[model samples]
Target: MVNYRYLGNSGLKITELTYGNWITHASQVENAQATACVRAALDVGITSFDTADVYANTAAEEVLGEALKGERRESLEIFTKVFWPTGPGGANDMGLSRKHIMESIHGSLRRLQTDYVDLYQAHRYDYDTPLEETMSAFADLVHSGKVHYIGVSEWTADQIRAGAALAKELRIPFVSSQPQYSMLWRVIEDEVVPASREVGVSQIVWSPVAQGILTGKYKPGQAPPAGSRATDEKSGAKFIERFMREDILTRVQHLRPIADELGLTMAQLAIAWVLQNSNVAAAIIGASRPEQVRDNAKASGVEIPAELMTRIDEVLGDVVERDPARTVEAGPRSR
Candidate 1:
């Protein structure tokens, strides 16, 4: 069974290895495969699921809802996000304005076949909308019992501080911070982690395997293998290009011995590394296949030694992206 942790200061406990359907559901695989993966996650005791309305234009949430049908809703935590363009791409179709946030939540609940989601997140910091307006909308959802908790994704530390302050005044549970965190991407550590800690927010990290880079499947100085994310031009390839350099690949290969010494697969090692952080309430793992879920679930309780963690940092060296500015840079400048 997977270990569980409290999300921020909230009483709600989530599986440390939560299932996320980002690219795998609806877009990358068929419905059957996606459901099989979800079943595999349940088999491994993953009770927390993360999704976004923008994923496959809201199809991912529907797939997740269908897959999770018949399970006791009380025993699970279903999370979804707003703040991205879904449905028609109208001027008001996206962002964290009251109109979009309110409309988006209703559509998400309808598609998800759930009356309410456990955690409703702002998928990104909407620069165009007033922070007070966005937070007010979330507060209304919480008060109406449509959303249980609130979270944000990819917001800067200052942004989190501002939101958390507003959430405090509104008296809503601002519990989790969703960010891209892995061995390769350390952008959140410098600022976001500290701010979130102060504001009583824990991390629910995405891409703990760094888009499969830490899995040691992509060899240095060679073309990517067939059917890999790197080969998929439409979806995953662009997100992974930044880590495809020979030098980074070579450094990634160096972590193989550390994983071997730990008696874990590279993917397990990568996931475990993120869970080692106390602030990380859960690390979201997405899978295209059932076996991938089973394999990643093993990372739940594994603990890497301090010396090995140091060695991992040494091995990866300066290749790690520790810039705090990257957090803001990664978010949208408009909308």
Candidate 2:
């Protein structure tokens, strides 16, 4: 079983590890395999299910909804996001504008087969839309009972604080932020985490395994294993390429002994390392196979020693990205 943590200051408890279907269910695998993976996650005690309407152009939500059919809805926390263009469209197609946010939530509900979502997230900060308009729209969702809490992903420290301040004024439950956080990606630590803690927002981190780079499967100066994420053109292969450098791969290999010493898989060690931050409410893991879910769930409550943490820093050294200014902004609506 997995441990549950309260999301930020909210009373709602979410599993420490979240099962997210980003590039897996609708992009890389068929519905049958996706269903099996969802079941495997449930069997391993994952209650938080996350997805986005843009994932596979809305097919992912549909598959997840069908797979979760007949389960007690109140027993799980269903999370989804908006801000990405979901289909072929016009000017109002994407971003966190009031019109898009209002329309997208209903479509997401229909696709997910749920009346309400536990936590609805803004997938990215909308530079085109005014923050007040976006926050007010989210406030409307919360007040309407369609959304329990509000969250944002890949938002900067200033963005988080601004949203939290507005949320307080609006009396909306702005509880969480989702950012790509891992041992290899420490950008959140220097800014986002601290700002979030100050504003009562907890992090639900994604890419905690660093796009499977921390698994130690890819060797230095060698080809990535066949069918791995790095070679999967449709599934974040380009994003995974940044960590595939020989120096980075060599440093990753050094983590194996640390994993061995702790009797944990490299993936588990990486996941647990992220959970060591008290401000993190959960670490999100994506999987194309059921066994991957089983392996990652074990990291939920495992605590890593401080000495090993220092060793990880020494090993990873200069390769780690710790820029406080790092923030992934949304692209222009046209793109």
lDDT of 2 by residue, 217-333 (tens): 999988889999999987679889989899999999999999999999999999999999999999998888899899989888888889999999999999999987666532343
Could you give me the TM-score of model 1 versus the true structure? 0.99
Top candidate on TM-score is 1
All candidates' lDDT scores?
0.95, 0.92
Clashing pairs in 1: none
TM-score of each: 0.99, 0.98
Worst 10 residues of 1 by lDDT: 326-335
Error of 1 at 56 (Å): 0.4
Which regions in candidate 1 have their CA more than 4 angstroms from the true location? none
Full-model lDDT, candidate 2: 0.92
